[model samples]
Target: MNAVAGAVQALLVIGGAPLLTGLMRQVRARLEGRAGAGIAQPWRDLRKQFLHKETVRPRGTSEVFRIAPLVLVATSLVVAVVVPFVTTGSAIPPAADLFAVVALLTLGTVALALAGLDTGTAFGGMGASREMTIVALVEPTLLVAIFALSVRVGSTNLSSIVSSTVHDPSRVISPASLLAAVALVVVIIAETGRLPVDNPSTHLELTMVHEAMILEYAGPDLALVELASAMRLSVFLGLLANLFLPWGVATSPDPLSLLIGTGAIVLKVGLLGVALAVGEVFLAKLRLFRVPELLAGSFLLSLLAVASSFFLA
Candidate 1:
């Protein structure tokens, strides 16, 4: 039954990812006063990509080039399993410890960066270097934010945090809790390669980060990378949804409640995705050098939130 629940969550994340990406495009387009491609645009894109000839790397790149997409998709699929949407009763919920989740994401990132560098292209190397530099700043903030939450809940295990937050409403207004939420929001934008951090819409290679890493991928490989990206977006947003807004999550094992919980999770994720897109639409990308300053402010806010929570508690 646990496996069954896990499967349901996985499929929901996989299928919902494209839709979420499409919705964001729609939202961004509408906000900019144009009737953008409808919400199913991502699906249409993937189909076209699959049918077309894949862009290949110059010969001598070795198998890592081919394996990069698999690594990216596999890691994201694992993350989807660990993120709780409908229930705290995840089969591998313990694996959702904040540090462990970050590690999984980092592992995938390293593989992508290596693949980018292996391509031996100037653009690929530039993107990988910038991406790693950003990750160096991002990893610490993520840990600090999660550590604050763990201290308050007395456990870093996601299940416990959900229980504590859902059981008590006052925690939401607490300083630490709010700080983590804000920090994670900044992390979400950066980690997901969204606007004001990285623009997903731009084709100019000079401005790209994530796209540069996959510039050599073609066909199903590109599809996997794109799908994995959508999955990553879903996982991060789901984590935020379950972490800060834990009320609708299921504590019960009943199937009916699980069904209702699933619907609630989708609704919450969709709304968050739309809000992020709208935010991206209004903001321009930050100067590459200034990114650290923004992340540093996030770190300070997270620390302050934790300190406030500890004092208040």
Candidate 2:
């Protein structure tokens, strides 16, 4: 039963990721007073990419360049399975550890960074360097945010954390959880290459971080990378949604509950995507050098969350 539920959850994430991305784009376009691409546009884009038979591999690239997209998608799928998306009881409980989840996500980032370097292009190397620098600053805050929540539940297991908050809603109102949420929000913006960190819509070499790394990829490889990027963003948003507002998640193995949980998560995530779009409109991308300062502020917030959790307990 857990296996079936996990499969359904994973499929939802993989299939709906592009939709969420498209939805965000649509919302942003409307906010900016233009008719945006429809919400199904990403699906269409992926399908078109998959239909193309031509793939271009640079002259000096290695297997790492070819395999990074697969690893990235696989790791994200594993995370979707382990996370309490629709249900509190995961298909793989042991892998549901918060630290393990963070580590798996970090592994995916590392794979992409390596692939960027493997391309042996100046642009790729530049992107990789910038990405790693951001990762170094973002990761500590991410870990501390998780630790703040874990301190409340007495375990780093995601299920335990969700269940504890679900059974006792008071925990959600605590100082630590609020601070952690703020910190995680900042990390998500930076980690997903959103505005104020790296703009996903831009391809200019001067401002591009994620795009620079993928300049050498085409056709199927590009499709895989694009899909994986969407999935990663969706997974991060889902985590933020489920961890902070777990009201409708299934606490049992029942079919009806699972269905309701699915609906709940979709609604919650959709709202989050819209909120992100609205927020992005008011904010301009920060200068590359200024990114560290923003991340540093997040780190301080996470640190305060940790202290609040320990001292307020």
Candidate 3:
């Protein structure tokens, strides 16, 4: 049953990613008073890219460029499985350690950076440089923010924290939890390339980081990268929803309960996607130099979370 449930969870995250991306696009379109593409638009886009023959295998690029897409999607797919979607615990509960989850995400990001540099294009090199800088700054806060939760719950295991919160309820409002939540929100924005940290919509040479890295990829490679980006977005949102807002996440495999849990998971992810769309709509892209400042602020929130958890405890 765990195996079956695991399969379901993986497909849930992977298959649902394109839809979420499309929904964000649709929401943005509506806000701007334009007719949007279909809500399933990303799936069609992926299919079209997969069939196109524009794939450019740059002459000097190493195996890294060829393989990064596989690694990126695979790592994030593993993350979706480890994060409990309909359950308070994962199918592989031991892998639900929050630290390990973050590490896996970092690994995926590193693969993309390496691939970017391997392509030998100016845009690729610039993207790789900026990408690593952001990763380097955000990772520490990400690690310590988990420490905030670990300190409160006595384990870095995400399942334990969610389960404990569900069973107890009071811990969510603690100064420590609140501070960590605030810090983690910032981390999520930086890590996901949303809002003031980086704009997902931009492709300008002067400011683009994420899109610049992939300027050389096309066809199936581009499709894979795009799908992976969408998957990562869903994974981060799931982490935010399932960890802090664990209300309807399942604690058991009972059919009736799973239905409620699934519905709740959908609702939470949908609302969060809406929030992301709204943020993107209202917030102008941050000046390139200001990114470090935004991430630094996130780090401070995380540091304060750690201090409060220790001192307040």
Question: Each prediction's Cα lDDT score?
Answer: 0.85, 0.91, 0.85
In model 1, the worst 10-residue window by lDDT is 49-58
Candidate 2 stretches greater than 4 Å from native = none
C-alpha positional error of residue 290 in candidate 1 after TM-score superposition, expressed in Å:
0.9
Residue lDDT tens for model 3, 1-313: 4555567678878899899989998999999999999789999999999985578788998999999999999999998887777777677877888878888999999999999999888899999999999999989988887688778688898878888888877778877788888888888888888887888878788788899898888999999999999999898888888777889877776877777877887789989998889778988878878889988888898889889889997
Every model's TM-score: 0.96, 0.98, 0.96
* Residue-pair clashes, model 3: 0
Give the candidate number with the greatest lDDT: 2
How big is the positional error of residue 186 in model 2, measured in Å on the Cα after superposition?
0.3
Give me the candidate number with maximum TM-score: 2
- What is the Cα-based lDDT of residue 83 in candidate 2? 90
lDDT minimum window of 10 residues, candidate 3: 1-10
At residue 54, candidate 2 shows an lDDT of 76
**Model 3 misplaced stretches (Cα beyond 4 Å):** none
lDDT of 2 by residue, 1-313 (tens): 5787789889998899999999999999998999998999999999888896478889978999999999989999999998998988789999999889999999989889899999988999999999999999998999999889999688999989888888988888899999999999999999999998999999899888898888988888899989989988989988998888999999888899999999998899999989998999999999999999999999999999999999997
